[model samples]
Target: MSTGVSTSTDKIIVDKSRGHRNKAVSKAVRQTRERLQSGHASSSAFDRDVLQMYVTAVLQGAAIMPLFVIIVAALGTYFAEDASLLFWALLTLTCHTANILLARHARTKEITAEAARRWRNLLLAGQFLIGCCWAVFALQDCAACEPSSFTLYKGATLLIALSVTTMSNFMLTPAVLVGFAPAVVALAARSGLSRDILELSLAGVFTVTVVFFNYISDRLFQFSLKILSFQSEKDDLIAELEVAKSMSDEARRRAEEANLAKSRFLASMSHELRTPLNAILGFSEVMSAEVMGPLANPTYKEYAGDIHRSGQHLLDLINEILDLSRIEAGKYELSEEAVSLLDITEDCIGMVQLRARAKNITIHDQVERQLPAIWADEKSMRQVVLNLLSNAVKFTPQGGEINVKVGWTAGGGQYISIRDNGPGIPEDEIPVVLSAFGQGSIAIKSAEQGTGLGLPIVQAILAKHDGQFILKSRLREGTEVIAILPAKRVLQSIPAVEQARPVAKKRRSFA
Candidate 1:
């Protein structure tokens, strides 16, 4: 039973090892495919950035190496001879100066892929030479040196050199390996020449450390590649957004120009169009009334009346279109006045009462008495009331009730509300009703099709007065439209009778 248990454990371990090996092979294959595909693309920018980072690292090492060399030279027991110490110092200084100059030159050069490759080679060569100079210390015989001192000196120098190169070149895996391989080889060779068990063991440990650092360098390289790729994608997205914004601005500008042209055309032709329309309406009315002479046939009179009505309707439509165009073009100028809301509402009610009576629709009005006058354009205010009442009468069913109310608002403003019980607009079609030349689905199916500019004109006029217009409706229920004049537009004043009775009230005694 114990043998069988051991066999099962061995099988599990073997399976795990095989799984790891397969995973590694798969990863290597995917990486190779990616490299082959990416090789065709231009990597100039990536190369430039990598080269810049490399130059920076090289410059930093040049600054730090001279200090390290000085410290090592001061601590070494064999370097008491002035000539030998000076030779070592000069060699180290020369290598450092050459590397500094090379780094500076590389930094100033425009980096292409070829240029980056050349710089990498030059950098690795400089590192190799610097490593050789340090290795000479390991090769030097210190006759007065204790075994402990010699070991300490060699280990410290090699470890410090390894740390510096590893940190500097870790961004590029191949560069790191090439730059530090010489130093690793030198240390291992020196250890073997010493023929000491402890030294050989230390050398093996150093080689293993170098391999571990190389692994870390490869990981850092992959991380940097991912970061760079992400940055590239971010830059592309920003460019696309900028392009979209520019296109939107251009489209908006073109639309404004086209709208301006249309407004100008309408303004220019208004007189020409209205003159013909006025003549047609005038002549048709005269013929229908038989003012000049009796018509030859009764049917001719009826046709003439029809012509007059059609002409009048056309003129009203043209006027509405012109008004909407002016408002959109920012050309509508308000003729300001103090207009009584009650009086305007009454006039509008009287104007539309005939149409409501034709449909047998009862018009109910609830207006607050002595409502304050509003500062507004009188003609515009009249148009606003007429449009609302017209829409209510048009949409209200036969024998249905229409409610018109004018009163003070909760915010100390004046408002007019017109409601009708009819085939009310659907909620989704409300926006359509509000837009110019847009009608609800029900309106489209009705026998009376409107020009659809009435509500938009009313909205525009109210907006010009710094007021708000609200329309609320639910399908098959009812529609309510409200026009509100802002509080600032409400005039503060006393009526003539009230002002005249002030002296009489002052003379009266308190009851």
Candidate 2:
């Protein structure tokens, strides 16, 4: 009932804070994405410092290995009189110089992606160049060697390593695998040993295995991140749905309370109205009979008759209102008993026949010859039939036919159809016909005054009995109302004989 409000100062502060938060989050997200896409830039302190340290360590390690080999080879040349000591010494010196220059260059600044890729490629090219130069010198010593093919194959392996490493720095394993494996094989084949082919095949298999492992690891890491993201989103959506469900439940509870309050208010109003109405009718009847004095003229008597009739009508309306309130409160309970459908139908027709006769309308009863016993409260069934029949009589035109038919159907159900040759309901208004205080479009336009609670009561009663009420109509073709009731109570599992025996014994004792 109350409108929500926000003070101007609070609104301004909230708006400003929200805008600032949105801008900050957007900027941070963009920067993080950009950094992930691009490689490290120059002058980044962390990158320069770490790369420099790593490059220094790598050069130191590279020199130690080559230095050990050079010293060992020199000793071998001196002791065993080997002829290629000069070539071996020059090769070691060249590798040391290249490592020193690379280390110094790395220390100067951070390595950008482009610079890293370029230098990596150049280093691979140098490895191939040095291997080829050594192989060429070996070929000259052994004339049977085809040194050019081996050199070309080694160059291809180096190119593959460079390409793979550029694609991903994490591809280090694959890069090292492809780079060295083929070169080792080429070296073996050039040596002209009989087992060299087997060694080359093993190296090829080893390289493929390394690449396979790297691919599987990369895929696994990606899949893990994706699964975590999916679960987080699912949890957030479930939380939102739970909040919506709680809000809906609260709204439903409030609606039910409002409906109960309305029913209670109507019941109280009806009670208050009926009290004064009874006194008015009672005093009018006394005056009409001249308990105090006789009417002065015949016209006065006619006026009194109108007042009595109107009073009765108002009483009927009040009773209908009270009955509807009881139905809404679920205070109208059915007391099951055996009653014949034929009897009820005939009785209802007899009650409303005079009203039909007043309008020259014929009330017809076509009850089935062998109607089954229905389980219901006899008084309530009487009310249901009377209300329907009376309503039919009120709406029937002169010479119009009112039909009441009863029959036993299959599935152990009894049906009573009440039909009348009256203006039928509009098709679109059919759904609202049973709703409380709602009427058909045609009914609204007509002069007939009704509380509009009759069908709602009928529906509620039928629902209590676990039965059904159906309406079918067409414009200018009359309307049919069907009430279906089960032949038996479908009582709980307690035996009927056990229930009857107690009543029979009591009757015998009384007798």
Write candidate 1's Cα lDDT for 1-511 as tens digits: 1222354534443343334544554565555455444533334457767668768877776667788777777766344343465577679779878878988988887878666777777877876777667666655555666665677667777777677767777754565566556656766787778787757766787778777877887787667766776676565556555555555665565576567556656765677688899999999999999999999999999999999999999899889989998898888999998889899999999999999999999999898998978899999999999998988888898999999999999999999999999899999999999999999989888737668998999999999999999999989998999999999999989557645444443576789
- Point out where model 1 deviates above 4 Å: 1-45, 56-63, 66-109, 166-176, 193-242, 494-511
Clashing pairs in 2: none
Q: Where's the lowest-lDDT run of ten residues in candidate 2?
A: 165-174
Tens digits of per-residue lDDT, candidate 2, 276-354, equal 8888888777767777787889687777777777898889878877877777677887787977767877877887878
RMSD of each: 19.0, 13.2
TM-score of each: 0.77, 0.55
- Report the error of model 2 at residue 211, Å: 7.9
Please report the TM-score between candidate 2 and the true structure.
0.55
Please list the residue runs of candidate 2 whose C-alpha ends up more than 4 Å from where it truly belongs after superposition.
Answer: 1-218, 287-293, 297-300, 369-372, 489-511
Once model 1 is optimally superposed onto the true structure by TM-score, how far is the C-alpha of residue 250 displaced, in angstroms? 2.2
For the record, the alpha-carbon RMSD of candidate 2 to the native fold, in angstroms, is: 13.2
Q: Candidate 1 — what's its lDDT? A: 0.78
